[model samples]
Target: MTARWKPNVTVAAVIERQGRYLLVEEQCPDGLRLNNPAGHLDPGESPAAGCARETLEETAHHFVPTALVGIYMARTLQPLEGQSEDVTYLRFAFTGTLGEFDASRTLDDGIVRTLWMTIEEIRASVERHRSPLLLQCVEDHAEGRRHPLELLHVDPSVAGAP
Candidate 1:
């Protein structure tokens, strides 16, 4: 029997302050790359909650997701060890308010540091991005493409209720 295919699910926080957007520099298989503060969605948590958690882990800043920016899907060949495999990612992008930074926290593995970049700078660094969605999410947020957070309904069963 063939194995079932499942797209990896992730959540990202598109945080803007003044005229810059928050981004993370992380180590990737190809090299260092920039991306929105994002990570895989954890089990038993809503996408917004996952975004908040990933933002804190990657940027050491508290994030409160206010709106859903957009959902994106992309497929790529990811290198693992000496082999490459096709991978599909389903990402939930969100716009939100950034709160206080925690100086005592350490960033997640592979995450080097967080920085703020203008849209122009981001546009110029497309080749250095982890994925194209990095710029797309920021552009969507800049264009005021937002949907109410109420659009996502997390049923209790997501927490493993019987």
Candidate 2:
């Protein structure tokens, strides 16, 4: 039987304040890269919840996702020790209110630090981005492309069968 194909599902928070977007610098296999507070979605949680959780974990700030910025798909060839593999990702991007930062909380593993950058700065540092989708998501958010949260329906089954 052929193996079924599945794209890695992830969530990201497009948080902007005072004309700057929040991003994280992290250590990846390639090196340190800049990206929105994003990570793989965990089982049993809705995408918005996952975004909020990832944002808090990576940035030490509470994020309340109020709108869906966009859904994006991208593929990249990841270089392994002796081989390269193509990986596709399905990302749900969200824009929302960023609440208080917890000074007592340490950032997630591999997350070097979080910083705010303008569009110009983000565009100038394309080579340092974790994924191209990082800039696309930010541009979409800046263009005011937002969908209602109700567009994503999470059935009770998402939490698992009773």
Model 1, span 1-162: residue lDDT tens? 999999999999999989999999999999999999999999999999999999999999999999999999999888899999898999999998999999999999999999999999999999999987899899999999999999999998998975
Q: What is the C-alpha lDDT of each candidate?
A: 0.94, 0.96
Tens-digit lDDT string for candidate 2 (1-162):
999999999999999999999999999888999999999999999999999999999999999999999999999988788788899999999999999999999999999999999999999999999987999999999999999999999999989985
Off by over 4 Å in 1: none
Candidate 1 weakest lDDT stretch, 10 residues: 153-162
**lDDT, model 2:** 0.96
After superposing candidate 2, which stretches have Cα over 4 Å from the reference? none
